[model samples]
Target: MKRVLCLTLALLSFIPAVLRAQEPAAPQEGLNTVMQKASYIIGRQFGADIKSNLPNVDVKALLEGINEAIEGKPSQLTEEQIQATRVELQKVMIAEQMKMAEADKKKGLDFLAENAKKPNVKTTKSGLQYIVEKEGTGAMPKETDDVVCHYKGELIDGTVFDSSYERGEPARFPVNGVIQGWQEALQLMKQGAKWKLFIPSELAYGERGNPAIPPNSVLVFDIELLEVLPPAANK
Candidate 1:
């Protein structure tokens, strides 16, 4: 997930401090030593999650590969053999991911079909569905306009993927620069309007979804349009 990757990157950024701490110094004065020890503890916590995702991974072989690479030593496998293995593994991963995506796509389609029948839900020609929660008397945003809004996004399964509300901040971006569903819906909405948007995968992330969202997943969003600003403001 995106959050996991972000946390990992944040933790990895501390490696420099850890390295610097390895310098000879009095025990009490050694921040780097303290950091290195802390990193190992944190790494084990993160490593457990990584290992869960890679259940079939050979831990010993992986450590050996890392150690050999770091020591500038030849690997037990030849370059050609390694390349072949990597290519094979890539194919396997892709195949498995696609199989999961197909299942998700079916579930998304079924959910959308039933959701469209609900009262007040309007389906657009692009297969985007939305329910206007509040009407605004203010002007509508143009395609090139930048807008400020608060939004909560989730998958069809009701798994929260992202939210500006949770962060206690509103997000601002170009109306045309977002996903197709948001683009269409924003253009139709006036400033101060609130809507519950149901976006099919095609109008959302499609087949290759981002780290937080799975492939072909339908996305739901609760959005409140706060302000429509000039496009130049963002630039």
Candidate 2:
């Protein structure tokens, strides 16, 4: 039942163009209408996405399934076949993800080992590494203190995932409310301090990463402590 539902969903994904045909695509002389241009652009994006994720696709079978679904016709494949496909696809995906995660873990371990040897970088017992960019004159924040700070988070490959400076605003949050790595760093930082942090996966999001992050990723952050406020009222 679940496999049939998954197959049904896969077909439904391609039929949205028919369901949301509010603005029609005109005759294909020159892509004149907004809907027509959108259709082509969306097709390109979807093609790229499917090419990457659904590796070694059977194009003929895929198109046949899509066409039948759009035309409201019966499925060509039997329930048993669909179930087999679902089970195999799931296994393949799990294997690929595990392989990737293992590679990332090894990469992170090597990176931390090399980074800890740098004269400027300080390593804590928890495997958090940091370089003090600028010393601060203000008092250090307690774990309960709310701090306003700007930070840029990135992967080891220099892919920026999050940044307060890019958003043109500083963020205010309790020191202990964040990930273990950030919590450790915030307590050690005083107002007006600047530091670059290398956070291991164990202290970061770890195996269960969010949409913006991947599993077993080693994260780097450039952090500036602006000001430390009293503990939040709700806290």
Candidate topping TM-score: 2
Candidate 2 local lDDT, 127-187, one digit each (tens): 9999999998897889888888999999999999999999999999888889999999988
Best candidate according to lDDT:
1
Model 1: per-residue Cα lDDT over 1-235, one tens digit each: 3445666787678767666766565556433466546756666855676575555678888678757976999879988998999789778877878999999999999999999999899999999999999997798999999999999999977899999999999998888889999999999999999999999999999999998999999999999999999767767
RMSD per prediction, one decimal? 5.9, 4.6
* TM-scores for every candidate against the unseen true structure: 0.70, 0.79
TM-score, candidate 2, is 0.79
